[model samples]
Target: MRRLLVGLIVAVLTVTGLLALRAELMTVEVEQPEGSYTEVLVAADVVRENADVRAEMTHGLVSTCRLLVNADVVEQSFRAVGDGVFAFRLRPGLDEFDRRELRGCLSDLRVQHLRVHVRHLQTVTPADDDRRRDGTPAAGRR
Candidate 1:
Protein backbone atom coordinates (compact mmCIF):
# COMPACT_ATOMS: atom_id res chain seq x y z
CA MET A 1 0.00 0.00 0.00
CA ARG A 2 2.85 2.36 0.88
CA ARG A 3 4.57 1.66 -2.43
CA LEU A 4 1.36 2.34 -4.37
CA LEU A 5 0.89 5.67 -2.49
CA VAL A 6 4.46 6.73 -3.27
CA GLY A 7 3.99 5.92 -6.98
CA LEU A 8 0.77 7.97 -7.11
CA ILE A 9 2.50 10.95 -5.48
CA VAL A 10 5.36 10.72 -7.93
CA ALA A 11 2.94 10.61 -10.87
CA VAL A 12 1.08 13.65 -9.58
CA LEU A 13 4.29 15.58 -9.14
CA THR A 14 5.44 14.63 -12.62
CA VAL A 15 2.13 15.75 -14.11
CA THR A 16 2.28 19.05 -12.22
CA GLY A 17 5.82 19.71 -13.33
CA LEU A 18 4.95 18.97 -16.96
CA LEU A 19 1.94 21.25 -16.79
CA ALA A 20 4.03 24.10 -15.40
CA LEU A 21 6.64 23.68 -18.09
CA ARG A 22 4.06 23.49 -20.81
CA ALA A 23 2.37 26.64 -19.52
CA GLU A 24 5.64 28.53 -19.47
CA LEU A 25 6.57 27.42 -22.96
CA MET A 26 3.15 28.06 -24.39
CA THR A 27 2.90 31.66 -23.18
CA VAL A 28 2.73 33.94 -26.19
CA GLU A 29 3.07 37.70 -26.47
CA VAL A 30 0.82 39.07 -29.20
CA GLU A 31 2.26 42.40 -30.25
CA GLN A 32 -0.21 44.36 -32.31
CA PRO A 33 1.36 45.65 -35.51
CA GLU A 34 1.71 49.41 -35.60
CA GLY A 35 -0.17 51.26 -38.31
CA SER A 36 -0.53 54.80 -39.60
CA TYR A 37 -1.19 57.92 -37.64
CA THR A 38 -4.25 59.42 -39.31
CA GLU A 39 -5.84 62.79 -38.95
CA VAL A 40 -9.55 63.27 -39.55
CA LEU A 41 -11.26 66.51 -40.37
CA VAL A 42 -14.68 66.75 -38.84
CA ALA A 43 -17.26 69.04 -40.35
CA ALA A 44 -17.95 72.32 -38.59
CA ASP A 45 -21.62 71.52 -38.23
CA VAL A 46 -20.90 68.30 -36.41
CA VAL A 47 -18.54 70.02 -34.04
CA ARG A 48 -21.04 72.72 -33.41
CA GLU A 49 -23.70 70.13 -32.62
CA ASN A 50 -21.51 68.56 -29.97
CA ALA A 51 -20.00 71.77 -28.66
CA ASP A 52 -21.59 71.36 -25.25
CA VAL A 53 -19.87 68.03 -24.68
CA ARG A 54 -17.11 68.04 -27.24
CA ALA A 55 -14.62 66.04 -25.23
CA GLU A 56 -17.08 63.29 -24.41
CA MET A 57 -18.17 63.14 -28.01
CA THR A 58 -14.57 62.81 -29.11
CA HIS A 59 -13.95 59.94 -26.66
CA GLY A 60 -17.08 58.18 -27.84
CA LEU A 61 -16.02 58.59 -31.44
CA VAL A 62 -12.56 57.17 -30.70
CA SER A 63 -14.06 54.21 -28.83
CA THR A 64 -16.44 53.53 -31.68
CA CYS A 65 -13.69 53.79 -34.25
CA ARG A 66 -11.47 51.43 -32.24
CA LEU A 67 -14.26 48.84 -32.22
CA LEU A 68 -15.04 49.34 -35.89
CA VAL A 69 -11.41 48.82 -36.92
CA ASN A 70 -10.70 46.10 -34.34
CA ALA A 71 -7.45 47.94 -33.60
CA ASP A 72 -5.90 49.73 -30.67
CA VAL A 73 -6.12 53.53 -30.46
CA VAL A 74 -2.89 55.32 -29.64
CA GLU A 75 -3.07 56.78 -26.15
CA GLN A 76 -4.14 60.44 -26.07
CA SER A 77 -4.31 60.48 -29.83
CA PHE A 78 -7.65 62.20 -30.04
CA ARG A 79 -7.32 65.97 -30.09
CA ALA A 80 -8.45 68.97 -32.03
CA VAL A 81 -5.72 69.99 -34.43
CA GLY A 82 -7.60 72.93 -35.89
CA ASP A 83 -11.13 74.19 -36.36
CA GLY A 84 -13.23 71.06 -36.79
CA VAL A 85 -10.10 69.02 -37.44
CA PHE A 86 -9.45 66.16 -35.01
CA ALA A 87 -6.58 63.72 -35.18
CA PHE A 88 -6.11 60.23 -33.77
CA ARG A 89 -3.80 57.29 -34.34
CA LEU A 90 -4.72 53.66 -34.74
CA ARG A 91 -2.40 50.71 -34.49
CA PRO A 92 -2.75 48.46 -37.54
CA GLY A 93 -4.08 51.19 -39.81
CA LEU A 94 -7.33 50.96 -41.66
CA ASP A 95 -7.51 49.09 -44.91
CA GLU A 96 -9.84 50.17 -47.69
CA PHE A 97 -12.61 48.11 -46.23
CA ASP A 98 -12.01 49.53 -42.76
CA ARG A 99 -12.00 53.04 -44.13
CA ARG A 100 -15.30 52.56 -45.88
CA GLU A 101 -16.80 50.96 -42.82
CA LEU A 102 -15.57 53.80 -40.62
CA ARG A 103 -17.01 56.36 -42.96
CA GLY A 104 -20.34 54.62 -43.04
CA CYS A 105 -20.41 54.35 -39.26
CA LEU A 106 -19.47 57.98 -38.74
CA SER A 107 -22.03 59.09 -41.28
CA ASP A 108 -24.73 57.72 -39.03
CA LEU A 109 -23.80 60.19 -36.32
CA ARG A 110 -25.53 63.57 -35.80
CA VAL A 111 -28.21 62.74 -38.34
CA GLN A 112 -25.70 62.35 -41.13
CA HIS A 113 -24.25 65.81 -40.71
CA LEU A 114 -20.82 64.45 -39.79
CA ARG A 115 -18.26 64.62 -42.56
CA VAL A 116 -14.77 63.20 -42.03
CA HIS A 117 -11.70 63.46 -44.22
CA VAL A 118 -9.14 60.86 -43.23
CA ARG A 119 -5.54 61.49 -44.17
CA HIS A 120 -2.58 59.29 -43.30
CA LEU A 121 0.16 61.61 -42.11
CA GLN A 122 3.10 59.19 -42.06
CA THR A 123 4.65 57.73 -45.13
CA VAL A 124 4.97 53.97 -45.63
CA THR A 125 7.30 52.26 -43.18
CA PRO A 126 10.29 50.06 -44.05
CA ALA A 127 8.24 47.00 -43.18
CA ASP A 128 5.56 48.10 -45.58
CA ASP A 129 8.14 48.57 -48.30
CA ASP A 130 9.45 45.06 -47.66
CA ARG A 131 5.94 43.64 -47.73
CA ARG A 132 5.19 45.45 -50.96
CA ARG A 133 8.34 44.05 -52.50
CA ASP A 134 7.36 40.59 -51.30
CA GLY A 135 3.91 40.92 -52.97
CA THR A 136 2.08 40.54 -49.68
CA PRO A 137 -0.47 43.10 -48.49
CA ALA A 138 0.55 45.44 -45.69
CA ALA A 139 0.06 44.33 -42.09
CA GLY A 140 -3.68 44.94 -41.63
CA ARG A 141 -4.99 44.74 -45.17
CA ARG A 142 -6.85 41.74 -46.56
Candidate 2:
Protein backbone atom coordinates (compact mmCIF):
# COMPACT_ATOMS: atom_id res chain seq x y z
CA MET A 1 0.00 0.00 0.00
CA ARG A 2 2.85 2.44 0.78
CA ARG A 3 4.45 1.71 -2.60
CA LEU A 4 1.17 2.32 -4.40
CA LEU A 5 0.73 5.68 -2.63
CA VAL A 6 4.26 6.78 -3.53
CA GLY A 7 3.69 5.88 -7.17
CA LEU A 8 0.42 7.85 -7.20
CA ILE A 9 2.17 10.89 -5.75
CA VAL A 10 4.90 10.72 -8.36
CA ALA A 11 2.36 10.38 -11.12
CA VAL A 12 0.45 13.44 -9.87
CA LEU A 13 3.64 15.49 -9.69
CA THR A 14 4.60 14.48 -13.18
CA VAL A 15 1.17 15.37 -14.54
CA THR A 16 1.30 18.76 -12.83
CA GLY A 17 4.72 19.48 -14.32
CA LEU A 18 3.51 18.55 -17.77
CA LEU A 19 0.44 20.77 -17.41
CA ALA A 20 2.62 23.72 -16.35
CA LEU A 21 4.87 23.22 -19.33
CA ARG A 22 1.91 23.09 -21.67
CA ALA A 23 0.50 26.27 -20.20
CA GLU A 24 3.80 28.07 -20.62
CA LEU A 25 4.01 26.97 -24.22
CA MET A 26 0.47 28.14 -24.93
CA THR A 27 1.22 31.74 -23.98
CA VAL A 28 1.55 34.11 -26.98
CA GLU A 29 4.57 36.40 -27.01
CA VAL A 30 4.21 39.93 -28.31
CA GLU A 31 7.19 41.89 -29.53
CA GLN A 32 7.52 45.55 -28.67
CA PRO A 33 6.28 47.75 -31.50
CA GLU A 34 8.63 49.98 -33.48
CA GLY A 35 6.80 53.29 -32.88
CA SER A 36 3.45 52.39 -31.33
CA TYR A 37 4.09 53.79 -27.87
CA THR A 38 6.59 56.40 -26.80
CA GLU A 39 7.54 57.22 -23.22
CA VAL A 40 7.94 60.97 -22.73
CA LEU A 41 8.78 62.77 -19.49
CA VAL A 42 6.59 65.91 -19.23
CA ALA A 43 6.55 68.96 -17.04
CA ALA A 44 3.17 70.66 -16.59
CA ASP A 45 3.07 74.42 -16.49
CA VAL A 46 -0.02 75.89 -14.91
CA VAL A 47 -1.27 79.05 -16.56
CA ARG A 48 -4.53 79.69 -14.69
CA GLU A 49 -6.58 78.52 -11.70
CA ASN A 50 -10.31 77.99 -11.27
CA ALA A 51 -12.92 75.27 -10.78
CA ASP A 52 -11.44 73.66 -13.87
CA VAL A 53 -7.69 74.01 -14.32
CA ARG A 54 -5.92 74.72 -17.60
CA ALA A 55 -2.30 74.04 -18.43
CA GLU A 56 -0.03 73.52 -21.39
CA MET A 57 2.38 70.67 -22.20
CA THR A 58 5.54 70.90 -24.27
CA HIS A 59 6.54 67.68 -26.04
CA GLY A 60 7.26 66.37 -29.50
CA LEU A 61 4.22 64.08 -29.73
CA VAL A 62 1.82 66.07 -27.67
CA SER A 63 -1.14 64.55 -29.45
CA THR A 64 -0.30 60.92 -28.61
CA CYS A 65 1.55 60.87 -25.34
CA ARG A 66 0.49 58.95 -22.28
CA LEU A 67 1.82 59.42 -18.80
CA LEU A 68 2.81 56.35 -16.76
CA VAL A 69 2.67 57.16 -13.12
CA ASN A 70 4.70 55.61 -10.31
CA ALA A 71 5.48 52.43 -12.24
CA ASP A 72 2.10 51.25 -10.97
CA VAL A 73 1.18 50.04 -14.47
CA VAL A 74 -1.51 52.66 -15.02
CA GLU A 75 -1.12 55.15 -17.89
CA GLN A 76 -3.04 58.29 -18.92
CA SER A 77 -2.74 59.63 -22.44
CA PHE A 78 -3.19 63.31 -23.07
CA ARG A 79 -5.03 64.57 -26.15
CA ALA A 80 -3.88 67.88 -27.48
CA VAL A 81 -6.87 70.22 -27.64
CA GLY A 82 -4.90 73.22 -28.85
CA ASP A 83 -2.00 75.53 -28.13
CA GLY A 84 -0.29 73.68 -25.20
CA VAL A 85 -3.60 72.44 -23.77
CA PHE A 86 -4.24 68.74 -23.48
CA ALA A 87 -7.07 66.54 -22.32
CA PHE A 88 -6.30 63.63 -20.04
CA ARG A 89 -8.53 60.59 -20.11
CA LEU A 90 -8.58 59.39 -16.53
CA ARG A 91 -7.73 55.74 -16.04
CA PRO A 92 -6.94 53.42 -13.18
CA GLY A 93 -3.46 52.63 -11.75
CA LEU A 94 -2.31 56.15 -10.92
CA ASP A 95 1.02 55.64 -9.20
CA GLU A 96 3.20 57.73 -6.90
CA PHE A 97 5.32 58.84 -9.81
CA ASP A 98 2.30 60.32 -11.56
CA ARG A 99 1.21 62.07 -8.42
CA ARG A 100 4.71 63.42 -7.91
CA GLU A 101 4.85 64.68 -11.47
CA LEU A 102 1.47 66.39 -11.18
CA ARG A 103 2.52 67.86 -7.87
CA GLY A 104 5.59 69.32 -9.48
CA CYS A 105 3.36 71.01 -12.02
CA LEU A 106 0.96 72.31 -9.39
CA SER A 107 3.83 73.64 -7.33
CA ASP A 108 5.11 75.48 -10.32
CA LEU A 109 1.74 77.12 -10.99
CA ARG A 110 -0.42 76.30 -7.93
CA VAL A 111 -3.14 74.67 -10.06
CA GLN A 112 -4.13 71.54 -11.98
CA HIS A 113 -3.65 73.08 -15.43
CA LEU A 114 -0.20 71.74 -16.01
CA ARG A 115 2.04 72.40 -18.99
CA VAL A 116 3.84 69.13 -19.71
CA HIS A 117 7.10 68.81 -21.61
CA VAL A 118 8.52 65.46 -22.58
CA ARG A 119 12.09 64.87 -21.49
CA HIS A 120 12.51 61.28 -22.74
CA LEU A 121 10.78 59.46 -25.55
CA GLN A 122 10.58 55.66 -25.96
CA THR A 123 9.18 54.89 -29.37
CA VAL A 124 8.06 51.42 -30.53
CA THR A 125 6.86 50.16 -33.91
CA PRO A 126 3.43 48.91 -34.91
CA ALA A 127 2.25 45.34 -34.32
CA ASP A 128 2.27 42.59 -36.93
CA ASP A 129 -0.42 41.52 -39.39
CA ASP A 130 -1.89 38.85 -37.11
CA ARG A 131 -2.90 41.46 -34.54
CA ARG A 132 -4.47 43.76 -37.12
CA ARG A 133 -6.10 40.87 -38.99
CA ASP A 134 -8.65 40.55 -36.23
CA GLY A 135 -8.94 44.36 -36.04
CA THR A 136 -7.11 44.51 -32.73
CA PRO A 137 -4.99 47.60 -32.25
CA ALA A 138 -2.14 45.47 -31.00
CA ALA A 139 -1.14 45.46 -27.33
CA GLY A 140 -0.67 49.06 -26.27
CA ARG A 141 -0.48 50.15 -29.87
CA ARG A 142 -3.45 52.48 -29.53
The candidate that achieves the highest TM-score relative to the unseen native structure: 1
Worst window of 10 by summed lDDT in candidate 2: 65-74
lDDT of 2 by residue, 1-142 (tens): 9999999999999999999877644423344433333333344454554413333333322332323221221244655455444444323322333433433442343323554554333332345345767787644322
Residue range 17-125, candidate 1, lDDT tens digits: 9998776444243433454433344433354466645545655766776696576767877777766666666665555555555655555563343445554333234
Angstrom error at residue 107, model 1:
2.3
List pairs with backbone clashes in candidate 1. Answer: none
TM-score of every model versus the real structure:
0.48, 0.23
TM-score of 1: 0.48
| Over 4 Å off, model 1 | 1-39, 47-52, 110-142
Report every candidate's CA lDDT. Answer: 0.58, 0.42
